[model samples]
Target: MTATLDQPTAVATGVVVRPWRAVLLRVEGQWTWYRRHWTASLLSSGLQPVLFLAAMGIGFGSQVRPGPLTGGMPYLAYVAPTILVSGLITIAVAEAGLPVLSGFKWKQDYWAVASSPVTPGQLFTAELVWITLRLVLGSVLYLVVTTLVGGWTSAGALLVAPIAILTGAACATPVMAFAATTKGDGHAFAAVNRFVVMPMTLFAGTFFPVDRLPVVVRPLAWISPLWHGNELARGVALGGLRLWPAVGHLAVLVGLLVFGLVLGRRCFRRRLVV
Candidate 1:
């Protein structure tokens, strides 16, 4: 008689591990790698936002006077929160794109881990947890710099951290799902940066009001997670956050997050299981 060992048989024999435990183990592995090689991430995710704020908010802002355009605040204060959110979205794109593709295709790390007891859903969850950690750390650093550079207008600006994290996760999860479906040398990721990331950063109310955009193009901003995040962050930071509007913005971000999680899990399962 020949016998085969598998997860189902292991579970029957009382060797089951909890799902969250598996997810945490994967997250720990990611953290271990990141701890050893976090400098590049720090450069893009931490320092880049500060450079953007200095250049756009202080440098060019010096030439422009605040008025209806700035929502009646200093340009630095007006643009700071949105810039933070946009920067996170950019980080999300980078994290969720090539790295995700590499896990499945170039590196085949997902397959190697799948040969263990870890499931695809756990892997997807761990990826999200790691991305969220990056967003949280980046947001904190950006907020600290914003406060130091006189970009913060209210104590409520502190709330931007959560908003930025949500915005990043919303962007990251969907891109992670897309990356799972991609093949080749990750050329699609470049197109994503050019078409999706750049458009969202430039037109999604990051640097200016969406209403300032051409009427035909305004809908693009409305669909952007960055725009929703920007609105929430600016409202709380600069004051004047209306109840219904805040709820609506939260709903949009939450919807995107839920949608991405669903799609990302399905994609991970499809790729890893088969």
Candidate 2:
């Protein structure tokens, strides 16, 4: 290889050197924060999806066997992406919960960090970035678990790992935005999860196709960030991604992310100052 470099190589003192120190520092900080509360993290992300995967896919799979969802596929393969998306949503929900509450109430660490070198917007951005990082980790772990439990297919499902991260980030934008608006715990998160997150998770076609549900219920899936992410994940995992549909998934995801970020920044300013 003629000088392999994953990042920028600069000429320093007449020598070509890659400065990874900054990247390494950020990685260390992320890891430091992650390790402190990884157990609760795993409960929401990895285990939650795994449980659903088995309960519906294997347990109830016999009841729905040989259907379109099977798609001439094993029930496990067909359901894998949905599980991955649910895992992403679970991660998103976790991101929306305690961390937001802690930042506003228990810890107040975010305010302190914002007061220093970091601005409120930067603090929000950093936390969002951290959520994405967590999403990536949880997705990878879930994929591995699924694989070992016999969910891997075509080696393409391996690609679903990082896609889960993007899927997670897509929803995380909204989660963080929602978090940024809060003045107190005050059961705000409880309401968001009960009303918003729960409905999305249940009706969002994660376990089965939206068409299977009544027409009245299917529309909710269209509005859900997780549903779009699930569609994208299923397409990628099953190799069913067509141009228009793929573009549709991407468009919806990006739109949600943009909306979340823009609204979230405003919320950050409002909550942090006046």
Q: What tens-digit string does per-residue lDDT give for candidate 2 at 1-274?
A: 4456566676445432223433343446667976897775677646777777788777876576566656777787788888778777777767766676588777877676555444566656666777777677667777777888787677778767766677777777777777776666647777777887777777787777888888887787888877877787787788878889878878887887778777776777777874
TM-scores for every predicted model = 0.93, 0.83
User: By TM-score, how accurate is candidate 1?
Assistant: 0.93
lDDT (Cα, 0-100) at 83 in candidate 2: 78
Model 1 accuracy (lDDT, Cα): 0.88
- What tens-digit string does per-residue lDDT give for candidate 1 at 63-173? 888899997788999999989889888888799999999999888899988777888888888899988888888888888888888888779988988898898998898
Model 2: CA > 4 A from native: 1-30
In terms of TM-score, which candidate is strongest?
1
Q: In angstroms, what RMSD does candidate 2 have relative to the true structure?
A: 9.7
Residue 243, candidate 1: how far off, in angstroms? 1.0
